[model samples]
Target chain A: MDRFEYAEARLSSGESFLIREKGVNLYDGNEKTSFEGGEVVLTSHRLLWARPGDIPRGLTCLSLPLRYVVFVEEETGSTSFGFSRSKKIVLHLSQALPGKIPGPVNRSSHHYMKLSFKEGLNSNFVQIINETIQSKKWENFSPAATPSQASDVKLRAGIVGIERGIQEKQKAADESISRAFQDLSKLMGMAKDMVNLSKNISQKIRERQGDITEDETVRFKSYLLSLGIDDPVTRTDFRSENKYYIELARQLADILEEPITDVGGMMALTDVYCRVNRARGLELLSPEDLIQACHMLEKLNLPLRLRQFDSGVKVLQLHSHSDVNVVKNTALALEDQGSLTAEELAQMLGISVLLAKERLMTTEKYGKACRDESIEGLRFYPNQFLQRED
Target chain B: MAEVEWPWQYSFPPFFTIQVHNETRTKQIAAWRSLILDYHKITKHCILDTREAQRTALFNNTAIDRKLPLEGIVTILEDLARTGNAQPLDKQKHRWQIYWHTLEEWADLVYSWVQRCGMMNTVCTLYEITDGDNSADEEFHGLDTEIMVKILQTLEVSKKAELFDDNQGVKFF
Candidate 1:
């Protein structure tokens, strides 16, 4: 089955999307026992009843094809069993099985399949079933014609008007094409002599665009004349460009997630900025924009959060990250060497020395570690707790 | 000469580093206080110059190749002073006289020594108590003169000894 979308009433592939209503109901078929509060799905293909995430085989629920559905009728009398008004869908099948049986089978014995729904829901449901039975394909089922079609027609007319305007513009473009061909033919005949003149015109155009001095424009135009992109992205492509930027952000988030885990669930924001921009190739983002995107991730409730260290080094970390693990790791590392330098811890933790120092400081705050500041630079050791060595 | 065995942590590199965190630093200060007192007792030395201690093996462990910088030693000494176990001997506060034994303890020792030597009523010069040949067998022999004066002053304050200015000494009664 195709992946199920949570709470979506739609069906999977090979199943029909034509769901009239879906809610808790009873399926009392050939068996006297009733399945209580089971999710009843009425589709064009089958009457599928499941237990939320479970599509049980034989015991709880079953899928009865619509072809076997003999009739569907609403029993409007409110029963003491506390249905809003139970409606039963009856199916005459070629086979009787105690449990759910998938696929086509030859008839051994005939049996009836009955399912019920709550009140007021059976009217449109019966109509939908009738439509499904009469129609050749499930796609043909539609409710009564609506005014939306009329609006659709008006929209088509508006598009036609716009097409006419485009055609008028196309006519002007065709005229320009012909005039450009005439100039091209003249240039072909006088190509050798007009080269300098064409170059001068290009230079003048470059000058009109501004910022290019005469000499540099003459030099730069020569380079542009040799090569140019067909359709470089611009302001007109903002919608598509925005989509690409969002994709880049997602890619950056994915790339950083693993490295962040490898480095004990935190990474320097500036280091990530350089990495993300480099990964984007030509589409680099400014540092401020990268920070904004990180903020956006926090708002989106992604498994990432931004934090600033005491040394002012901003870091991105997993949402579940805590200092408890760092303290534990410090004690563990101390068990191996009894003492640790900031550089050594940096190597072991896959982080910078500055970050390692930060972790050590936090560890010391809890008395898990103590530091020695000597001529060899600062180092940390497991303190009273780890020293006990139980 | 029997070699004095230092604690295992003395050779540990971080032992020389100044602790920055309060909890760890508290433990570190306590450890240093004991070490300083033990070091003075073992070496029979009293004065601790911060600059000199940086090179001393007790403060800087050469075997582990870790040296406590002068600043760190000064910090530890300042903490010692705050705890009343050491007193700064100079205006610059760089020189400190470690009180492995408090002045009162030294005064008691001296009073008992005078009684044992049958000099209870005799006037003894301050130099005789510190550097004199008679005090050679005593634990306070070659004691810091300033510390000796402080000890004598304690004894005088308690009426155990009387100061005699003419002889620049104290007479025990």
Candidate 2:
């Protein structure tokens, strides 16, 4: 069957094509009236027409179920356009059907559609439409069963029961698969909650124990302590790797908060990673994962942030870290020592020499310290801020 | 007055690192400009060799254990040149003449030195104004010979003195 793009006809599932007649003129009234030119379509389940040319009317597109077709009729030279002859396909709807008309087409309405085909088109359309209507009627017929037919009905009934059983099993399997996906997400959320719970537990434990000896609550408490945390939860709780990393990042941030301040508010990222991993005990994180965790801290809006010097040295620092404070501290240290190298600064600040170098350079740039370059490397002394009495 | 002290930031290690951000770089460049000009003035030095400068205490901070690398020093000097505070002499930009005092300031100093020594309008050898016996009490005394010539050249440009290229002498107006 030829399909028209303008036709809004929907073929029901399993409905097959029958006939498509173009240039069929439709006239609801008698002959001598103008007609609308369009294509007429017929399918196993529906009959539809779409006006090819622009037509000024209430309904330019028509669709009705095949079941509503009452009969097909042929009229001689009686079309509204005074065509030589035309075939009228009359549809008697048993119930109201939705069409291009504004409201539902009335029930029991007789729709007279005339198709004027030249030569052999009318005959073919009439024959096909009649056969379709008859087949549809026969499909709904319930014949009185003879003895042989009764046995065939019982076999068909048994086959249908087995098909239904299979369908039920498939539906159950689909439901379980969907449920499993939902369960997985829920478990992920629970893992995150567990991290929080563990931290809370550790906090409570520390609060309650004035000075509990290492012998009591050794496994759980020691695990918490190993993570450099007083939280009740440890790294082993989360099943998913990503969730575990996120928890580690949070714990690392918390653990470093105090140490960073004590170490002059910043420390090399490698040093931080090593200390954090050591605190986490056997569950050591790779460098990439540690870097990712630090990045996650920024996204998580934690108080700690990562900074990379133009020299490509990466460090983790508190958001409140100020270069001024590091300069001040360096000046204080230099007050007594007069001048010290990176090694001495690292020792005084209790930070890595690399970190000390970074801070000292910043302090020097601030002009609070002056440097003395020698074969032994560089050392700084309090410049403008601290006066050295000879 | 006490010696001009460096602000605390000069000892910062990040200060040695090249600043990538524009705002910080601008501030760093300014800080470098002042430091270079001030140090050169105090030391009465003119040319700054990049390699030698990096090895000096001016670029190295021992207290913080940091030294501005050669490349970083070059960047700072280039910034100083851009601001007209220093002039790069070599095509490769390895050597720089730091303009601690502008040509006008040098002219003023030399012209005043001539007046103070009662040598105004006198044709004096370029070497005499720098190393001559009478030049001792003058501020331009013992100045770098090339710098003193350049200062006399400035005085010539302003029509305050005439240069006798044949004898390498200058006649002050």
Among the numbered candidates, top TM-score falls to 1
Expressed as tens digits, the lDDT of each residue in A305-385 for candidate 1 is 778877787888888888888778777887788788889989986788878888887788878887766556677777852
For model 1, the stretches where C-alpha displacement exceeds 4 angstroms are A1-259, A279-283, A296-300, A349-354, A372-378, A384-390, B1-3, B112-122, B127-138
- lDDT tens digits, residue span A1-390, model 2: 111113345554566767777667654424322434566667775666666532223243565555556677656443347645444544333433222133122322234444554323646776787788878843443333112244344332455557756777999999999999899878867866766687788777677775665566466676656554444234478787778768777887888899887876788887897887766543457898788778788878888888887568999999888667777877788767877889998887688888888777776676666665544667776663223222
* Candidate DockQ scores, in order: 0.37, 0.03
Error of 2 at B9 (Å): 19
Measured as a fraction from 0 to 1, the native contacts recovered by model 1 come to 0.81
Cα displacement (angstroms), candidate 1, residue B173, comes to 4.9
**Least well predicted 10-residue stretch by lDDT in candidate 1 chain B:** B1-10
Lowest lDDT 10-residue stretch of candidate 2 chain A? A96-105
Interface RMSD of each: 2.6, 8.7
Cα error, candidate 2, residue B71 (Å): 11
CAPRI tier of model 2: incorrect
